[model samples]
Structure formats: structure tokens, C-alpha cells
Target chain A: GAGVSQSPSNKVTEKGKDVELRCDPISGHTALYWYRQRLGQGLEFLIYFQGNSAPDKSGLPSDRFSAERTGESVSTLTIQRTQQEDSAVYLCASSLAATVVRSSYNEQFFGPGTRLTVL
Target chain B: GIQVEQSPPDLILQEGANSTLRCNFSDSVNNLQWFHQNPWGQLINLFYIPSGTKQNGRLSATTVATERYSLLYISSSQTTDSGVYFCAVDQETSGSRLTFGEGTQLTVNP
Candidate 1:
């Protein structure tokens, strides 16, 4: 089975430029998430999508960050007017389901990640 | 938001040695997972043990939900085991959102 996959393993962007990172979740995964990991830092939650329900945007650090998951397969995280502070590795993960009951036992499979470097 | 903490921010061990990594959370969680991020920054899922114990090859993990903590054990470590180990938890109130700990950096010397 194919694991989750992300595009443009590495991206160097000028500050204030926008960038779009893409993720393809495993077939049938009902839950998808985005996270950012800065150098020598832990991962910070960005956004999450569960089925067709409203996405959880509480974790998005600012309005410049937004994510969209089409159906239950592909997801894109876009950063408008990127800042140097936004430079980090963006990771995508997916699971079988999003409900707490099902998520209790379901392991989230992560993608290789997209490294965004804002200069 | 739930807080997650990992112990021994960094560790160095000779190959074949065994080590234990700990993760303590401030609140109850519905999901707890262990991940290994290799030198290349690829996150590999190690375990999804929110409760009880599970082992795979030389790695094993146990989570005591009631106690609000989990432990990951690696035995007979190899140079390839040199990486960062992270513990992430999804608090009951956060639905499926995972809060990750700072992670433990492990260095295995031959």
C-alpha cells in the first residue's frame, strides 16, 4: 500500500511570496492533518479535516495559513505572504477515522514532508 | 490545550544498549502515538499505544492512560536508530488534533 505523499520535498521562497504544499492521503483515510516543525522544535498543529464536516482551524497560527482537503483524499496547505518565521517542514498525516473512538486505535501515517524555507 | 513533555531532551548510547523514553501529558487523551524521525526528517510511526503494551522488533511502548504517561523502550539499538523520538497525544477535547512533545534526540554510536 502507498503511504501518504507530499510534493516538492524542498522549497525555497522569498519572504512575502505565497507557497502551496500538497498532500495525498492513503485511500479511504477519513482524517487528515497538517503540522509545522521548525528547526530543533516540536511539531505544531496547523489544521485538521474530518470527513465532510467543518475543518478545525483553531490550530492555524494566523489568517495567512489555510488548508483545504478535497473530499477525503488530497489536501493543500497554503501560506499567503510567507514570513521567515514560517520556514519549517510541513508534514501531513492521515488516519482511518477522526472520531475519538476510532482514532484511539488508529495510527496516523505521515508523509515525507515539504520543507519550506522562507528567506 | 494539553501539554506534553518528553524526558532526557537528548541521549547518547553505544550500539546494542537499551534505553527508555518517557512522555507525560497534562490531560487525559484518546490517542497517544510514538514516532521516530530519521536524520532525513521522515516521520515513521512507531506505535499507537494509548493504553496497554505493544512491541515490534526491537521497539515497544506502553501507555497508562489513567496515569497520564507513556514509555517507549528500544533494545539492542543500532546506528540506524539515531534520530528523534516524539510522543504525540490527542486530548479528548481536541477531537483528532495531536499535540506533540519536544521529542527526545537519540544518538547511537557504533
Candidate 2:
């Protein structure tokens, strides 16, 4: 694909229902990241996947939030028992490799983002 | 945790005018980047500048690693340039997780 892509550009769900967001990263990119943007605010890091393993999941808001990557391709972020506070735009990005550790920092290319609204 | 702060939270400019946005980080970072979020909420990479300066067309950016600040300059702005500008960084202490600023909302009028 030319760039990172995400599914279900807009999703509306009830407060207690669970929701899942999917991300398809750029081909051959081994590192993927997830972020969340609330209304009138900058994005907040949710998790980072270096290949299939997530080295950093510190930003996950709570136990309700979790993500998994399939090898180096697709990734899914699941919000279990969503709340009104979970409403936000979920963004996915991919890079050639981990930044800083690599000899050259790889720029992360982001997807169109999934706007999740919990009623 | 490193905190990112962006100045001029809101900006209004006439088309063909110029503007400058500023970003300051609380700690050292291994990488820094500037991104433009369009009205559609898609993030566009503008510059991957951790240090030094880079120019592309009417947009230019400069980062002073030692001073812990970065500046983005947009010359001859257009209505299409109106949107939100964000500054993000990766620090070794945080496993290089990208932390973003609150962003500056820019409005360019014709």
C-alpha cells in the first residue's frame, strides 16, 4: 500500500459495548504505533509494536485498552467495555524500524485515523 | 516523562502572510518531528528535524537540541495551510515513545 490505512473511519457505540479498531501498516514496515486524540487536544501515545512484540505499552489508558499485532502487518486495538471517555480519534502509524535505536530515525507515517464515539 | 509545550495556541493570518510556531520540550530527545493535521484529521509529516534546520518550499523548521526548542516557519501562507500543527519527540528515557505537544491551531484567511 502507498501509506498506512485504518478501518471504519467513524464508529459509534454504546457506553458498555466493546469496540475494535484495525490498522494496516505500510508494507515491510516492522514497527507500528497507536495513538489517541481527544477533542481539541494533541495525540497521546497508546502503544508501540516493534514487529510482533510490543516493547512499550505504557500509554494504554487502562485495562480496558489492549492491542495486538500480526507479525509485521495488521494490528488491532480493542477497547473493552467502552465508556464515554473512550470517545476519541484512534490513529495508527508505521515506520521502517524503531526510532533512536536505529542508525537513522525512521519517520512514522500515520493513517487516516478512526474516530470512535461512545454514546 | 517529557512534556512538550507549543506556543501561540491559536494563530490567525491573511493569505500570503507569514507565521512562526514554537515548541519547547522539558527534556532531551533523540528524535523530533513536526506534523500538520489537516481538516480531515490526517497527520502529514512536515519535518523530521531533531537538530539543525531544513527547508521545503515555503515551509522551514529549525531545532536547537541544546536549547530544547524547535521553530516552524511558514512563509506566504495559504488557506490550505490552515489546520493544526503538532510537535512530537522521542526520548531515550521513554524508550523513544513519541510524545506530542498540545498543538497550535492555525487559521489562514483569504
Candidate 3:
């Protein structure tokens, strides 16, 4: 089985620029999530998508941060006017389903992540 | 919003030893999971025990939902076990989303 994959393993951009990180979830995964991890820090929730329904964008830091998923497959996290504080590794994960059952929650798989550097 | 806390922010252990990691949450959660982040920043799912116990090889985790806490245990630790372990709780408030802990940085030396 193919694992989740992200593009542009490393990205270096200037402040105020916009960056888009893409995520390709595993086949048949109905739920996708994006998280950010700063150096020496924990993973911060960004956004999540379940099936064809609207995404849960509550974790997005601000209006500048947005994400979109098409047909329960690929997802993209876009940070507009990126700031130095936005420099971090962006991670993506996917699960077969989003049910909160005791057994299903344990199966989320993750991608390698894209390290974005805002210089 | 939920708050997650992990104990012993940093730990140093010798190979072949055993260790325990703790995670506490501020409120009830529907989904509780443990993850191991390697040096390369890849998150590996360790356990998704919202309650009860689960063991995978030398690692075991238990989540006491009633107490709002979870414990991860590693026995006969190996050098490869050195990494940051995080506890994330998904409280179904608006949607199923995870709130992560600050994480516990563990270093296992051979």
C-alpha cells in the first residue's frame, strides 16, 4: 500500500511570499489532516477534511492560512503572505475513516512532511 | 478547545532500560492517540487508545478516559527509540480534530 506523500520536501521563500504545500493521501483514505511543526516544538493542527463535506478549518491560525481537499484525495495547505513565524515543517496525515471509535483512531498514517523556510 | 500536557519534558535513558511517559488532558476526549516523531520529523502512530491498554512489541500504552490521562510504557528500550513522543486528543466539538501535547523528548543511549 502506498503511504501519504507530500511535495517540495524543502522550500525556501522570502517573507511576505505565499507558499502552497501539497499532500497526497493514501488510496481510499477518506480523511486528511494538515499540521505544522516548528523547530523544537510540537505539531500544531492546521486543517482537516472528511470525505466531500466542508473541511474543519478551526485550527487554521488566521485568514492567511487556508486548505482545500478535492474528492477525499489530495489536500493543499496554503499560507498567504508567509511570515518568519510560519517557518516549519508541514505534515499531512490520512486515515481510512474519521470515526472516533476506539479501533479506528489508531490507524492514521503520516507523510514525510515538507519543510518550509521563510527567510 | 482542549489542552494537552505531557510529563517529563525531556528524558535520558540507557539502552535496555524501561521508561514511562504520561499525558494529561484538560477535558474529556473522544479519541486519544500517541505518536513518535523521529529525527527527520516523521510522525509514527504508536497507539490510539482512548481507553484500556494496547501493546505493540516492546511498547505499551494505556488511556484512562475517566481520569483524562494516558500512559505509554517502553520496555528494554533501544537506541532507535530516541525521539519525541506526542500525545494528541481529538474531542469531537465541531469536528474530529486533534489537539497535541508539547511532547516528551526522549534520548536513549547505547
Candidate 4:
């Protein structure tokens, strides 16, 4: 089975530019999540999408950051007017949703992640 | 919002040594997971032990939900085990969201 996949493994953009990172979740995964990791720091939750329900945007740092998931498959995180602070690795993960809970939580699998550098 | 804390922010061990990593959460959680981020920055699920205990090869984890803590144990470690170990929890308030700890950076030398 293919794991989660992210595009633009590495990206370098000038400040004030717009960048979009794409994520293709595992087939049949109903839950998708985006996270950001700064150098030497832990990952921060950015957004989450489940099935056809409304997405959770509480973790978005600011208005410039937004994410969208079409159906239950692909998701894109767009950062408008990229800033130097946005330079980090954007990781995507997916799970089988809450329906199948072998344990108390849905185990999430991650992608290679996209490293964004804003100059 | 829940707070997660991992002990021994950094650790160094010789190959074949045993080590224990601990995670403490500020609130009760229904989902507790342990992840190992490899050198390539890919997060590999180590355990989904929200409670009780689970063992896989040389790794094992135990989560005491009532105590709000979890422990990950690695025995006879190898150089390939060098990476960051993170503990994440999904508390009742967060409802399906996971709060991650700063993580423990482990370096295993052969």
C-alpha cells in the first residue's frame, strides 16, 4: 500500500510570494492532517480534514495560511505572501478515521514532507 | 488545549544499550501515540498504546492513561535507531486532534 505522498519535496521562494504544497493521502484514508515543523522544534498542527465534515482551521497560524481537501483524497496547503517565518517542513498525515479503532486512536502515517524556504 | 512533555530532551547511547523515554500529559487523553522521526524527517509510527502495553521487536511502550503518562522502552539499540522520538496525545477537549511534545533526540553510536 502506498503511503501518504507530498509534492515539491523542496521549494525556495522569495518573501511575499505565494506557495502551495500538495498532499495525496493514502487510499481509503478518511482523515487528513497538515503539520509544520521548524528547525530543532516539534511539529505543530496546522489543519485537519475528516470525510465531508467542516475542516478544522483552529491551528492555522494566521489568515495567510489556509488548507483545502477535495473529497477525501488530496489536500493542499497554501500560504499567501510567504514570510521568512514560514520556512519549515510541511508534513502531511492520514488515518482510517474513527470508525476503525484497533486501539483508542487512529494510527497516522506520514509523508516525506515538503521543505519550504522563503528567502 | 493539552500540554505534552517529553523527558531527556536529548540522549546519547552506545549500540546494544537500553534506554527509557517518558512522556507526560497535562490532561487525560484517549489516544496516545509514539512516533519515531527518522533522519529523513519521516514520522514512523512506533506504537498506538493509549493504555496498557505493546511490544514490537526491540521496542515497547506503555501508557497509563489514569496517570497521564507513557513510557517507551528500547532494548539493545542499534545505530539505525538514532532519531527523534515524539509522544502525542488526543485529549477529550481536542476531539480528534493531537498535541505533540517537543520530542527527544536520541543518538545511538555503533
Q: Which has the greatest TM-score?
A: 2
Supply candidate 3's per-residue lDDT for B40: 83
Q: What does candidate 4's lDDT look like per residue over B31-71, in tens digits? A: 88899999999899999888899999999999888898999
A2-68: candidate 4 lDDT, tens digit per residue: 8999999999999999999999999998888989999999988888888745457798999999888
If scored against the real structure, what TM-score would every candidate get? Answer: 0.96, 0.97, 0.94, 0.96
lDDT of model 1 at position A43: 94
lDDT rank, highest first? 2, 1, 4, 3
Q: Per-residue alpha-carbon lDDT of model 3 for B11-97, expressed as tens digits?
A: 999999999999999888878889999888888989878889999999999998999999999999999999999999887564567
Sort candidate 3 into its docking category: medium
lDDT score, candidate 4, position B66:
85
What residue pairs are clashing in model 3?
none
Candidate 3: where is the Cα deviation over 4 Å? none
- In CAPRI terms, model 2 is classed as medium
Scoring only the A-chain of each prediction against the true A-chain gives TM-scores of: 0.92, 0.95, 0.93, 0.92
Give Cα distance to truth, residue A115, candidate 1, Å: 0.5
Candidates in order have lDDT scores of 0.90, 0.93, 0.88, 0.89
Question: Which segments of model 1 are wrong by more than 4 Å?
Answer: A102-105
Q: Give RMSD to native, each candidate.
A: 1.3, 1.1, 1.5, 1.5
Query: What lDDT is obtained when candidate 3 is compared to the true structure?
Result: 0.88
Better of 3 and 4 by DockQ: 3
> Each model's DockQ?
0.74, 0.66, 0.66, 0.62
Against the hidden true structure, what lDDT does model 4 obtain? 0.89
What does candidate 2's lDDT look like per residue over B1-110, in tens digits? 89999989999999999999999999988888999999999999999888899999999999999999999999999999999999999886777578999999999999
